[model samples]
Target chain A: MPEMYFSDAIRAALDEALTRDASVVLMGEDIGPYGGAFGITRGLHEKYGPERIIETPISENGFVGVAVGAAMTGLRPVVEIMFMDFILLAADQIINHAAKLHYIYDGQVKVPLVIRAPAGAGRGYGASHSQNLENVFLSVAGLKIVCPATPADAKGLLAAAIRDPNPVLFIEPKALYGARGEVPEGDYTVPLGVARLAREGKDLSIITYGACVPLALAAAGELSEGGLEADVLDLRTLKPMDLTALEATVAKTGRCIVLEEGPLTGGIGAEVSARIGERCFRALKAGVQRVAAQDTPIPSATPLEHAVLPSVAALLAAADRLFE
Target chain B: MPEERLLSAYRKMLLIRLMEERIGALFTEGAIAGTCHLCIGQEAVAVGVAEALELGDEVVSCHRGHGHLLAMGGEPARLLGELMGRQIGYCRGRGGSQHLSAPGIGLLGTNGITGGGIPIATGAALSAHLLRTGAAIVCFFGDGATNQGVFHESLNMAALWSLPVLYVCENNRYAMSEPVCRTVAGGDILARPRAYGISAECVDGMDVEAVEAAARRALAPLRAGKGPAFIEAATYRFCGHSKSDKLLYRTREEEAKWRERDPLTLTRLKLEKAGWKETLPWIEEEVRRQIAEAEEACRRSPLTPPETALQGVYADA
Candidate 1:
């Protein structure tokens, strides 16, 4: 295994998918010689050429709908929206056509496609460019939402999403793109609806995913110095959440804190906390506390950006409530 | 085109007219629910274009799509079952009239949204081009759809890549009662695609021969992978936009003027002029019997079960 940046892992997965299947093609803006906005697909274009790695016009709705149509007509198209915010323009196709085709067409057709977007708000990219917008797609029934927090999971989940016969939204947190982790080179995958237990403890569980995974791990590390241990579970797949892993960790610790980097209202943290309250109420020893960003648009200035998003300090403070 | 081929096209146009007439009656009698968009006077556009299509050529239609569905060989029973929301429907009752599809004959679907199927048709053409499947796609949308940003986006992409697509714009004069004059820029629908570098033309949508000739000419360059072509079929809808529309937007005088040029009456008159005058009565009787049979089969079709709604939201994953 080699230590690879989160972006390299994504490129590796796309490279592998294109090589393994001829039906697989990449359609997006600036994914060719421009090396993509974040350079995740930097060199795959050179290797695959223009046809397989299509360079589409600056029409998000056009290309996204084309990908959906291509998916229906026996091609697996992986689309890249430069920024997550721009994905709003193509939401009608993603929600109306690609998501509903399977049911509406009575399973006669399957939209086997993946949409890769760079999301989240740690960078000072301002409100529209840096918001976490996957929450809007969470409730869409047929869509599978995969948010990878590590290089290994990013590669594995992306590859799985491409091969899976459904529309999958593979969101790479911008903060995690440059983060390095041990990743196996070829033919690797992490199944949807499964969680990675990052660390184990008996006192409490820190449930988080995507960008918040690192912060939760660091918070768990700090708590150990004072002899207060915690269990951290990274929920890589949001829509089909890992109920078994969530229950086991919460039942063992009897105390839990849900952490998310997005706004607290209607966020993934809200969904997870509600599920815990309903399913694990009898096993809990303390009320479940949620650590999340304030309900406001992320400011571009560094200090204000830091104030609006979740932090390890916030996770530690939420952890302190487990003892009280 | 031979007289027999003309007669066959005439029969299909006749079938679509009678089928819709029966469908309209069904709606009035409360046998079908939800919205119904009847393309009664626009049969020439559907049959003419369908006649020009070869095997494996798919079609994407709009809300006013019963004609297109029938023209592309969607079984009358399945389409009727679909309109009635029964299990025997094209989508197993999952898709009502507007969303029904027959993949067997390459009628991909009739879309629920205006201009929604343009990109999908473009994508299918892209797939055919890449895979060398030798398939072309025909997308039938209203003139009202030209205002959609996606219609322009899809046309731009198709022209840029030379994808094999035929964008057939049935300018039925209105988009749900807002006539093209009020909505489109200068009401110049053909200029949109022509600006995108696609070859566009206007055809007499009321004349089956003219519409079919235009479709055949359009398909020639498309099958050769010559990007996309656009055809603005100047036609009108005999019925209101939907079952609920009151026809207050236009006058009976205007309706009667268009009705005089009805596709069915014009095609039948052409056949009559060609010494096949006696065949018209016999052809109409057959069409009536065919629709009656379809309605009988629809009555026999089972209702959609409540439990089926939960199935197939996602493929086996």
Candidate 2:
């Protein structure tokens, strides 16, 4: 089989979803004929027609609510927010309505919707476009947050999300879209809330997701040369985190380092550290260290942006601190 | 309308009015916390539209939603228990009158935000269309909600999709002291929806029969899977916007004029003229019984524990 780019994997998953279920539809700004901004939904409009590949107005709140309503009624709508930054416009429907509807209704109603958006810095999109908001959604309950770094995981996780009974926020790393890797051709699904071991090690555990996963893997490879083998865990799903896998890795390594593209304060790393402290308190060797972006907006300058965000070097430094 | 159905309409309106009155008394006595937007004079709109709907059909209401709940055959005791912040309430007392839902009776939910339920109803209608179910959704909003951007967006989508939805605009003339004339730049609310390609009409909301007739005609397309419909019912609310509201905007004479066109009285007159003499007393007794049961339920219900306050924030657990 031919190797597929991460973006093509997403398109394949969407195509499969549309082909399998008539109720599954796609809606977003400039998504129909123009394809997606990153060309993830190319040729879907012509194949599915207007009803399934809907091109909506720029009103995020309006369309998001419509998707919520559509999802609640029976349609599994995969809505795309042009960028992760624009999701702030539809916060009410996403947070208050979609997130709480099921629990508020005592599980009587289900909002089986998927919101896909591109997240993380490295594109030089500046402060507005370059953001990792998985932490923000990690705070919200009733929502499943998935950040897939590889092409195969992207396709598998998206398929699982569309089939899942609850609402899922699927954040694809924009930096990794053009990157290519091997992916299966037939139908497949990757279970949510489960972390994947990118590489095996026993000296230290490195937990990360999205764009940081590849960087963490690179850091692990480099650390291995320095006689320190780091166990790299890719947290595919942020909420309902695979704490079991995390605890097992932490128990073996006795040290952990969290790598994130978002800010250090109130980041997902904070939540992970808190939970790990509560669960594996005695097993932890020094406190868990977080290697994340500086507490500042992402700058437009390439050098300044690189200085703020965590790179492979920063992850290596954090791991060294965990051992010391 | 049949003699029995006419009496049922009158009784439902009376029950809502009397229940609102009881809620008002309890609110003033400090038994109920938070704001209560009572649908005192707008009983006709709720009862009228509800009469034409099937048991499986859904309803999404606005802030002033007591009448909407009661009209959909919601238990007054459970609703009152919610208002009184008791665990036995519809939302486990987490949501007050403004956020109540009886999904079993097809009352999808009520929203506190003006024009919020519009999209929800549109979604519900879209769901019905997708599932091929004949269950149309009746979305109730005040005349004030007509100016909202969401209202227009939802109506346009419903029209474009031809979903099974009925947008019922309960035009009581005021959106919390802002008159319809000042709020609405357009002439008629019915025309606004009609511009969206939906078949719409204005009805005498004060007359139950007129409201039901309009609903029956509008619901035809939805039942046939043709598309959605809109109805603008010109009604009135006797009370202020909320419990803490002071009557500074409208005059006493204006309130009295609308009071004369009371929906309950109009329906009762129609029932009596049809030779149903025992209708009034029976409705009064039923209203009294419901109020007593609601009050008793409120008194006996338990309060939600503080620790469980954050329990339902997510569906994972």
Best candidate (score: DockQ) = 1
Best by TM-score: 1
Residues B198-235, model 2: lDDT tens digits = 88889999998899999999998789987888899988
Residues A1-324, candidate 1: write the lDDT tens digits.
Answer: 899999999999999999999999999999999889999889888899999999999999999999998999989999999999999999999999999988898988889999998999978999999978877898999999999999999999999999999999988899998899999988998898799999988889999889989998899999999898989999999978898899999999999999887788898878888899899999999989999889998899999999889988888888888888
Tens digit per residue, CA lDDT, model 2, A232-285: 999899987999998999999989998888999999999989989999999988
In model 1, what is the error at residue B186, expressed in angstroms? Answer: 2.3
What is each candidate's DockQ, to 2 decimals?
0.83, 0.49
Question: Which residues of candidate 2, in runs, are more than 4 Å off?
Answer: B29-31, B84-88, B185-191, B222-226, B272-278, B294-317
**DockQ of candidate 1 compared with the true complex:** 0.83
| Counted clashes in each candidate structure | 1, 0
C-alpha local distance difference test of each model = 0.91, 0.87
Off by over 4 Å in 1: none
Looking at model 2, residue A169 earns an lDDT score of 93
TM-score of each: 0.98, 0.91
